[model samples]
Target: MKRIVFFLGKGGVGKTTSSAALSFYLSRNKKTTYWVSIDPAHNLSDIVHKDLHIKTQIDDFLFAEEVDVEGYLKNFLHETTNRMKEMYKYLQIVNLENMFDLLKHSPGMEEYALMYAMKEKIEENQDFEYIIVDTPPTGLMLKILSLPFSSKMWIEKLIRWRKRIISHRAAIANINPKKIDESLALTEEDDKVLKELGYQSEYVTFLIDLLSDKSKCKMVVVLNEDAMSLSESLKIKSGLNDLGLGLDFVILNKEGLGTVSNNIEKIFDLPTIRMPYLKNAMDTNTLANMGQRLAKIVE
Candidate 1:
């Protein structure tokens, strides 16, 4: 089984360290595992003490990478521009490079790019027993995680619109065969656009199904004792619930509560795992021990 785990929380909440440690702990069990950092400000390399700017083999059973989001976005946008040119011949006059520069900063592009990168990773690396992801902080993380559900609707609508256009063209051509423009006739490019849209729609559906399958995926929300942390965690919980995804655990990092634990468990509706503040300097050894403790709780 290819099990995927996501570590999520507000910034400075120790998601990167916890995810790295957990990945190492799991790898020690002789299971093939890959640790990935998708955060734009990735600290996984420093935490893991390896240069993982690209995919690197830590050992026989463990691999690591800090995903290059900009790189993926560039490639994704280039392909998208090509597709648009195929579908709309007039698009050739519009400079796509400048258009993409603006589009890169658009609302949903980053999230969709990250989602597409994830889909590529999962499909390419199925031999690993576990794939652990250290996500960006709360807001972007939720958007990235929820892209499949939200994007599917838009893609489906686009598919329908394309089909209608094709049907209308066919009807016009049937009514007046002499009036049809050869260039306007349905070509291989139009067919390719339809195929590409269908593929994208199905890919998003696959992501939705994979994430909702709790047996294959787990979402770990890391929080601290601070009130702000708790509040952000609540929003994260609510958002996940709204998207019909279940939380696997609520990790209260850097503190332990005496009697307040009951309240936390009640509010989050999941078991709580408390990690003590690190009095010692953080290192591989210390993180490994912490991961051991976390494994006991999460397992």
Candidate 2:
């Protein structure tokens, strides 16, 4: 991907609006842009005055989607469970059907699903010049942002244990020739379990390297002039910092008669791209102007 920009902030802070504006701006510049909404709230349609459910072309250069997170999460679980069963028939005894229901509520399920949802989009839409994401609120965004590195660690450990198991099984088969080729792989090359883990390892590593690269990925926070939004933005920055990623810029989305206080720009210690309160966000003049301001960071 040429550039992937993520817009994140607290609820009601205009993350969707800022992201939509930037998408419009990029597309008008003739940069093929894929604007996706990962937030379960799914209000990107409200910005364009279009009822969007699937990937719909907004104009000549823009394609938009409101990801069905709930449905996608169910599919993600089903696909994951099926793959696991294929690799290990032993799991059949565990009542994977019931386990799937339980796994929905399991901790980190949403985060994992959201991470994979993003991965699917980025990998599938390689032809797009720019990929703009409107992320969920702060808490979930933080969890999702941290998942790649954490998942990589978990997979690495699993890979190590899998290799050890293969080595031990090979040793056992060598000791007793009668037990060789008993429907299980005795070598790393043939072990489906090891192969699966290796694939997951590589995928998560790709996410890690992609997000850590400033030239390709940009994390923009949208915030109003308020303590709560500012507080969340700070937490977002701290989380990104811990992950070896930085908040590239911020959009101070001003709405209504409220004038923006420049203190936010100083507080974040980064350039602020301001979006004036739009009386009619979908109006041609307003969007063109909004796109101009939001385009500063991307350009």
Candidate 3:
């Protein structure tokens, strides 16, 4: 089983920073790890100050990639559209190009595409010991995390609807010899795709198990000392509990004066870690130092 860790919280709360530091530290221990950026506004390359997109191998044990969702979706749409065109010939439809364009513009398309890519990576990179995902901000993170369930439900509904439509079409075709077999064929093809989606959703159970496994997988929620962030973190913790996922720790980043010292004892009931605010901006050296500090928490 792969150990998957996600650094998630609101934007500008240092999730990217924590993710980079943790990935770096984990790599040092000779674990094969891939640090992935699932955020649209990717700063992973900026933080490392290197172009690490498209499966760049930084070291023997470490790799990184910034998922290009649009690029992936374009390729996926092209293939799907071609298949649609081929199948539509049976329905005697003059063109299916417009439908392809409409599908591209459909709601939740991007999310579904990205989830498909994630599922692909998990299967393709079986050699890696750990996969560290740097997710988008809170709301998007929630959507992405719950995608498997949503996608499954949507696909099932589509399948049922398509089956009903095909049955109706077949009845119409029996009376009128011009019965376009294309619509039924297209529905069958879509059913196959949805079947794959259902299988992938089931496969995601491994990821969920890895996340909920207290000893193997850990979720570290990074936040600041502000009240809003703290409250959000608490809600996130509760949400994870509702999903049957356990949060191993809450890391309070860039702690200000009196906050860590005063609140540290109170928060100690929860497995909490803190890092002091640095005067200068972060660099690789600074991140490595922060990683050292975090290692103590893990120890």
Candidate 4:
């Protein structure tokens, strides 16, 4: 079985560093690990001191990659357009140049794009024993994490609408076939699209089950000693709980550097780990050390 782990926190809380460190530690321990950076503003390369835009093999057991969001988005849009054309014969003449532009501004487009990339990577990386993701900040990560449930709900509504359309089409055909435009008639492609949507929804549901399963998935929330970070972490914990996924643990980074207290354990009700503040710049050596600390908790 594949184990997938995520490191998420507020921006500037050292999530990338922690993720890289933990991945390094895991890989060193004979686990076939792949470290993935999914943040739009990626810093995994900088942390690992390697060019991992596509992927880089660190060793026989370790691989790393930073997803190119723009490249993935373009491919996603192209695939979507192709699917649309396949579903609608009239789409051959329709101009979608503006549709692509509109999608860039659409709400949740980035999150969906990120989710698509994640799903693809997970599917392609079945050979790896461990998959570790360095996610974006708290808010966006929440949206991406909730995609399985939200997308399933959306697909369910679409399926219902498609059934209604089919019913109306049957009624119109019985009344007068000429009254309904041939182009407006539901085609085999429409049914195919609905079937595809249902199929994808099932896959998403499986993903949700796997994620909520503690043995297969571990979600660690990284935070610092601050009220804002604490508040965000609380919200994240609540959100994951709502989705039936537990917040596995919390890592308090930069301990003893600030006046912020570590009384968060009482409120969050989860095991808390702490990393001391590193005065020097973080390189592979320091990261490995950090990873050693994280490794203890996971073990």
Candidate 5:
């Protein structure tokens, strides 16, 4: 029942529209749903025609929000720097504010911040029947999605090293009781660093399990009718496959195949959901109709 759907694709591929329509469909069916736009560009508010800059009730069961990705990123860095400073007293004289500025642009910062925000969201919002994520463009989103797996390995290694450090200290203390540093942990139980690494390992494991559980989580690729989009979509699939996660389906947004269906099926070897070109202006009714069409896939 972990209905978390991530709509991903190249930039300008209508990911927001596709995810929004699905939210409309599910909400109308009385399913408790949260439609979130994690894209930093913040198009969900304009697309949904509501002030979703804040989490807003769209209906009896649906909630919408355009996550402040930049704000969240800043807060994420602040908290991280603070924690590191506390753990390593040597950092106190190192001009943390300047370091914070540089770290803001550091590699993997956005992905880690977004992942942390997602962890917080999942932990806090447990009642929803669905949490539809409208992700950023392909490259960054792929990194964000696969972050837990990479983080798991790093945390595990850190834990092992911390344990060794604790064991070494205990051995030294045993040999010379007077030589022990009371400030340092001689046992694993008293080591805050080790305990933190353990918590991180456990959290990453939870994310890995959640992401690999296909029934609970689904990944959909949205694309245009061009060969470029299709090519990028394939890379997305390969990335997820590398992570041992399956791609549920492909949404050929602005499907232009006409009577020439099954091309997507042949390419992706998966079910293809077509959303035809929107000749008419976009509105709530159009989205609702599109959502209605998408409802069958969920059933």
Candidate 6:
């Protein structure tokens, strides 16, 4: 299973920078790694100073495009609508098309589609040792990670219902062979895809371990050295612990002016990575240097 390390925090923090830096370091160390951007306003290309639409091989590792969530949602809706049409035709119903259209607009669609895409990527890419995720802001980040468990529960219930329907139809199949043929044909295809979703534990556990693993995978929270950022860091720590995940470290970005305080030290036990305030935003060379610095911190 691939490890997924997330660089997450509030907006304007150094999450994207840290993600690019970590990916650079991992790749430099000869790991076949991938850094995926889940942030809508993606800046991985800016940090890398190259377009990542195609896989760019840097040193021993490769970087690929961020998951296009809208594309995933479109694909998912098309497949699901096709399946619904097949079922409606089998049952000789035309009125359900409106219902199907409404179903496409339901809540949680984006999250579900993203989870499906992530699962597909993990299953397909066996060569990569690590999949570094540059997640969105804190609230949305938690929702994305929690999706697998929620989706798994929903899938299990649907599987049970499908089994029950199959059994119920089996009794009537002998009496109505033509109807049974159409019904079974449609359901068989659905079962094939649904079965693939059934075996999603590997992907889910990969994420769980990434969140929980202190040694190999770490959740590095980036924050400014201000009262609000410090408070948010405490909240993030509590939330991660509530979810059975541990914070590997807290990075105080742009904290050059502050003298070290006892209160800040007491709030967090893990080693802190302090980055000085830069007059200008980072360029590729600067980001690469930051990557080297982060490598030392992890080491």
Top TM-score hit = 2
Higher TM-score: candidate 1 or 5? 5
Off by over 4 Å in 3: 86-89, 93-95, 157-216, 257-269, 279-281, 293-299
Please give, for residues 113-199, the per-residue lDDT of candidate 4 as tens digits: 888888878778878888888999988999999998889888889888887887788688789988776766455355666777777
Model 1 per-residue lDDT tens digits across residues 175-199: 9866666666464355666888888
Q: Where does candidate 5 have its weakest 10-residue lDDT segment?
A: 255-264
Predicted structure 6: clash tally: 0
lDDT of 6 at 233: 74
Cα-lDDT of candidate 4: 0.80
lDDT of 6: 0.68
Model 2 TM-score is: 0.93
Instruction: For model 6, give the 10-residue run with minimal summed lDDT.
Output: 185-194
Candidate 1 backbone clash number? 0
lDDT of candidate 5 over 1-299, digit per residue (tens): 45888899999888988988898878877899998887888788886678887789977778998888888998988877787666665445677667687888899898898888777776566678888889999999999889999999889888888889889889999999778756777888888788778878887887888788777788999988887788899999999999999788898888764443458899899988889888652576678778876664565
Which of candidates 1 and 3 reaches a greater lDDT? 1
Q: List the residue pairs that clash in candidate 4.
A: none
Tell me model 5's lDDT, rounded to 2 decimals.
Answer: 0.82
Give the number of the best model, judged by lDDT.
Answer: 2
Which segments of model 5 are wrong by more than 4 Å?
Answer: 90-99, 257-262
Candidate lDDT values, in order: 0.80, 0.83, 0.70, 0.80, 0.82, 0.68
Query: Per-residue error at 78 for model 6, in Å?
Result: 1.7
**TM-score per candidate, chains pooled:** 0.90, 0.93, 0.78, 0.89, 0.92, 0.78
How would you order the candidates by lDDT, starting with the best?
A: 2, 5, 4, 1, 3, 6
lDDT of model 5 at position 118: 74
